[model samples]
Target: MILRLALGLFAALALALFVQPQAARAAYPCPGGPGPGEVQVGVSGGSHGVAAVPICDRAQGGGGGGGSEVYYRYGSIAWHPDADDVWMEGSYDGPNTAERTALAACNQAMGGGCTSIGEWHNSSMRIFRDRSGALWSGWHGDGGVHSKKTLADCSAKQLLPCEVLGTYSSSKNRHLPKPTARKLYAVGAWVEGTEGFDSRLYIASGQRDAATAERLALDACTKATRQRCAILAFVGNGVIQTYRLGTGDQSATVESNAKRAAQAAQANCKKRGQACTLQRVYDSRTPGEFVHDFMAPAAK
Candidate 1:
């Protein structure tokens, strides 16, 4: 069993890691499952009775019982355990490109819900859904039975029986929901005081893009001051801190958390012999908006 697993994993890495596989013109059909282009399929290995092994093409000959002809293919699943089912279905096969592309699409799908999540690479992804409708993904190198082992692992953790969602190859964006067309975030402000220096910051989070985020922020500021609002800064998903110095300079920082950003900004201000006051703090996990007055309490 160990030898078989090692062989299969070797095949998966060969197909996915070394040279990029020739791009398929389109998805092909399979009878019972998701078809060649969809769920999974492979070559040479088919003669040996391997289903989704990607044909051992990347490595030197002599594997999967092959001596001369060699071919293997790789796959990646854009699976984030914390992601919603609708958000985790987008992915492709490139080694470095998979995670980045997946996150771009899924982040759009979930509206910046992936801030705290991480990513991964895998040759095969086994999807399982428990009776309660919670979805789980299992990953291993790649082989016909390799996917099965991962599926078993996934099933073991479930409180009930799981339904297999099929093993797939290459890039599969089939199930990703359309992005809400919402921008992630935007920050802006408009003047209001007699000196026209009201430093209050307004924000618009979860817009479709930077332009949208800024527009939303400015619009809110306009509503509040009944004047044209200018863009302060474009801050995205993270620990957002807005601050004002005694010198009347307004700035914001993006850090790991509210306190870190506040402290860093205050430290920077203190170096210049200026008073630093915290205007607002926004949650790093939140994909939403936050607003501020001209000034707020100092950081505790």
Candidate 2:
């Protein structure tokens, strides 16, 4: 149980980073501006960590995914690794929001004058900090090259006692797709009840199977800031929907579109004559490949 608790705490920390679109880093995303995609929810004030953080571990699935590209060009990061080791990280759709979220989160965690950040599209970013508190950033379209550059950056600066602060892939980050592959959609979250992007709610589409789709979405949720991830649902076609049942159970559904999905969720909760709320709905509009699942070509 102790071991499980420890691991849960670790995952919580990861979730914090994964969903931190509310952190401090701003000026770094890029002069180019925010890219394509949608942010379902926003985060508010507070310092969050594992102890009281929101998360739920209900399920899993599998796949081997490596590398990411921001062909969507939408992720912006807010980061401040102050020389005193006071730092925080968050993500956003553009520089302004990224900076706002990062600063809010960072100040809450530990007061600092954090004012640095970077931006990447579907690509990756890595940071290395030295004992002196000096920091270097590495960016590349390729995750592997970006990683190597991070280490080389410390070397170039001759910054000893250097260590990696964190690594990031933009919001749409995912592996390159196969031409003839089944498309799947999946949803996951750190905490079960809270919905939208702030809860580390994430979706992965166009996977090979239910396992792969769930794995991708869960993996993305884990890497981003959130509570703890639970696999909400998977489907081969239609849309993915999440909700809070009248009994308070967290669940999801696959419908043909956004309106139908929301209506279906509402109806399900209504069956109990209890309170229910439609949390999130990812229809054809959500972005990414919307196509594989346990339900096969469609949901039953």
Task: Write down the TM-score of every candidate.
Answer: 0.37, 0.29
Model 2 spans > 4 angstroms off:
1-182, 189-200, 225-228, 244-251, 284-286, 289-300
Taking the tens digit of each residue's C-alpha lDDT, what string does model 2 give over 1-300? 000000010110111222222323211221232223322111211111211111111111001123442223334333333222323333343434544554565555435534534333444455554322234455533224434534653444221224565555555332221222123334443433344324234677644344666676777766664546665554433466665544545456654456666765666667657676666556522446332221222322
Model 1 deviation from the true structure expressed as Cα RMSD, one decimal place: 17.5
Candidate 1: regions farther than 4 A off = 1-186, 191-195, 206-212, 226-228, 246-248, 270-275, 284-291, 296-300
What is candidate 2's CA lDDT for residue 178?
A: 28
RMSD, each candidate, Å?
A: 17.5, 21.9
- Per TM-score, the best of the predicted structures is 1
Q: What is the lDDT of residue 61 in candidate 1?
A: 23
Worst 10-residue stretch by lDDT in candidate 2? 1-10
